[model samples]
Target: MTVGQRSGPPIPLLGVEEEFLVVDTDRGEVVPEAATVVGRARPALGTRVGGEITKLQVETRTDPCQGVDDLHGQLVEGRAAVQAAALSAGLRVIASGSPVLGRAVPPPITEGPRQDRGTATFRGLHDELAICAVHVHVEQPDRDRAVLIGNHLRQHLPALLALTANSPYWPERDTGYASWRSVTWGRWPVAGPPPFLTSARKYDEHVDMLLDAGALVDQGTIFWDLRLSTNHPTLEVRVADVPLTAAESAALAALVRALVVVAGDAVDGGDEGPELVPELLRLAYWRAARDGMGGHGVDVTTGRLLPAAALAERLVALARPALDEAGDGERVEAWLGWLAADGDGATRQRAAAALRGRLTDVVDEIVAQTAPNVPMSEESTLA
Candidate 1:
């Protein structure tokens, strides 16, 4: 189970946490059924399956994995477990960033004092809080080094976001943007890319400032796209939307871990990394959210537009060394080839909607793709 720091070579270990939307197949929409699904899944998955901020969402976490193959198996198994639990309740799970179909109202938040406080403070913002994401945790024992590594990550966040843009719809219609989830998530006061921090001291200072100003509920409220994990000895990247399939999620995790390794190396060599203009970084994220891999993205370095796919390829090149170090180079390259041909989740979702001419078809596609190996009865697919 222990992944990082082995004798042969110190390959950085990584873990993935993926969130899913609980959907009612008959209604073809997300439903407030996470508690029920989690209850059923817990007996089988133990700590691996759990509820999230909204009752319509469930999440799975993998133990630290030494390589992508182990991580992919866990991701697939987690999806299968959640699917089994949802089917028991006549519900299905979809991996879309946003619900393809929903009622006019927001799904209810899970009841708790912490959840209640968030609801009270954020108010209407919580109405669209049913989005899900894929969070990758890479081993980083030194907090100061992790903070510096975050700076190295900021430039690449947009490319990462574009490749995993699964939420092209909201409620009942296409949102035009690929990752509506990113746009929706950025509404929070403390969300988006972390700012440049010189050291762990600066990182704590920033968190303390937010807490003192009530901009955050607690340290847990620091929802930066990348940050030093409060509960794990890892640097967490929360930038990607929940990918359409577990394979994509695993591939995304491998790329993230590679990038983190690259960043950590740069940090150790005393590379200050680029202190990008904050506006540029924000603009870059917006471009990725809007386009995914189907359009152009902003290159922070040159301040010029490039195809998002090109940017993503460049990112793979940047992480190639680290990828090879962990024996993931070929796997990551294969994923890139798959993405180039089949397109990202956003593209696939839109394609399904176009071909089937119904939002329900989009839901069905997500469900089937999420756990293709699991057999679903007629009732599980939308009629």
Candidate 2:
């Protein structure tokens, strides 16, 4: 069935989880100070601020929001809180997917049984796992519907990844992919594109199979590009990098919510979900990572190549009805227009590097884009 064939119900309530890399403000190197930052941020943000798997990453979540405008403001506030907290420690929070320059030695992991076990099991796999991502959660009543929506959402993941591709550098050199984080993440046992599924039962069955094979330590380790949340009644899209700024992150979240809405409408219309070759879907992910928004992308419908920007346009068109209905049509379009003219995080990072001939400049660019003009509240400011 063609995408955007029909309008969906009112936009589902959505929320965003944005992860950030903590870095030394002056030297621009990733720092293992997430605990300090999260500790400081929690006084104001409460449960909204948390530590990630690594000590260098901090994550922020906005409460479920009804509209893009509210979500955007929350995102900005969350970023500012983290920025302020990090600043208090002589550190900064940057939104790059991978650090421009990491320590010569491996970074420290957060101490937890699950995290420790994973560290023991994966060993060096977690070395480059300092990567960050922007996860968008759209509310669903149950896991079954969420799984069905995921099937419909799977085909669009690559395009979404292209639009939010922000990780272009790894350590000291460019990885030559728009999202090196996605590439590094694919090395996980349960990562990358998920199997074509028909129901929540199938999803559970697949999880059991992975568990039996020792591929996953627990159900929570199912790191598909999309999945049903273990702790919430939402379908989580974990494909995109942590965008360069709150505005871009908000726009990407809006698009994701629209996509989920459109997919749900199709399911209600009796569409079983489109099934594509698993190998081709993997290739599509690779293309999206390699080219991002500035190069060619795979047309998931036909398994053929299309320009990345055109694919993005096609995705926007597919979600137009939902966007218009949700009152986010203009804002999203304007953001897309800006993305086209200025490029995505990868493009901007490359431009910064070229202009200054230093990776530190790229970090500075990210720090500036993250939340430049927004005034921090007195509560969030450093003492």
Candidate 3:
């Protein structure tokens, strides 16, 4: 197929997908109650939030938003609806990438055709693949631009991962790794930063190969860190774990919007960015998987070693222009400050668990973070 240049208004928009674990508030154990919550929230579905692969997972997508303020409102409203539904079902939602309950025997498949197929495919790959993630999708002008943006964005994946790391404990065990969700996702054949694509045509060719090999059903099945959306004119970043709070999730989405604007502009202007070798990108991804924000450092372009803090500083500097250009600099900076000070949700949850000697406290923290009006002390009753 002949590839054409992307065509549309250059306005960048943002959408978010957050997955949460359903747990009994008192027991702090996983419950197959997501359906109940989702059912209760049906009147708000599509208008606010939606369901995901398992009975324990739910996802929220913001209405296409042009700025951080709109994004924030959508997130707050969506999460409120989900939390209310969960409360009505006598369940509390846990937002960590991997729940504290660990991997239980695969629950019976949820009711959708796509989810059923996804479950079957996942079961074929690993025995324990019950982790959750937050996928951020940013609209591009068209498919070609989406492909180009995905390619240029690959080098920065590690930086974004470091900032969003939230899954420290996995399977009820303290995994020293920062984001155990990365480890779980790595089990998939095509689940990391994608190899470079020279052009949109080449990307299509690669997708065709995967389909021919029976590795994927279609373009939607290509689960790379960056991929052209099969249904929308957007590039989706699927690297980060599900955040523990709606604020964190919104912050990540804002950053993604800024990154996409920068990359899309570079491609649109025919100024393909500084060539970042694939090997370096791969190594950087490994560093993100292993140390998260706590890791030493990453050379996004050269793949050389550096301290994680230093790398974060560099990324903030690099992204400042983009954030400013997109008029979201203030919000992005605020979010970064929160990440640096409190550490990511995973780090905070692990520390709280260690200090209190109970997973219930961690769950309570998540609940408090998710519901803005609910006081922390009241939320702690769950603990």
Find the candidate with the highest lDDT and give its number.
1
lDDT (Cα) of model 3: 0.73
Off by over 4 Å in 2: 1-10, 374-383
* Candidate 2 weakest ten by summed lDDT: 374-383
Cα lDDT tens digits for candidate 2, 1-383:
11223344456788999999998866788889999999999987999999998898999999998878888999999998998888887788889898897682377888989998787777888787789999999988667777888888899999899999999998889989999889999998888778788889998999999989877778888888898888888899999999998998889988888888888888888886889888778889999999898999998778899999888888999999788777778878988898889998899999999985988778877888887864433333222
Worst 10 residues of 1 by lDDT: 1-10
Candidate 3 C-alpha lDDT tens digits along 215-321: 77456778887787776666788899887777778778877876777677788788655567767776777778778776675787665798777777776676676
Instruction: Say which prediction, candidate 1 or candidate 2, comes out ahead on TM-score.
Output: 1
lDDT of 1 by residue, 224-261 (tens): 99989999999999999999888888888989988887
Q: What is the lDDT of residue 230 in candidate 1?
A: 92
What are the models' TM-scores?
0.97, 0.94, 0.90
Q: Sort the candidates on TM-score, descending order.
A: 1, 2, 3
Clashing pairs in 3: 102-171, 296-307, 296-308, 297-306
Model 2 superposed RMSD (Cα): 4.0
TM-score between candidate 1 and the true structure: 0.97
lDDT of each prediction vs. the true structure?
0.88, 0.86, 0.73
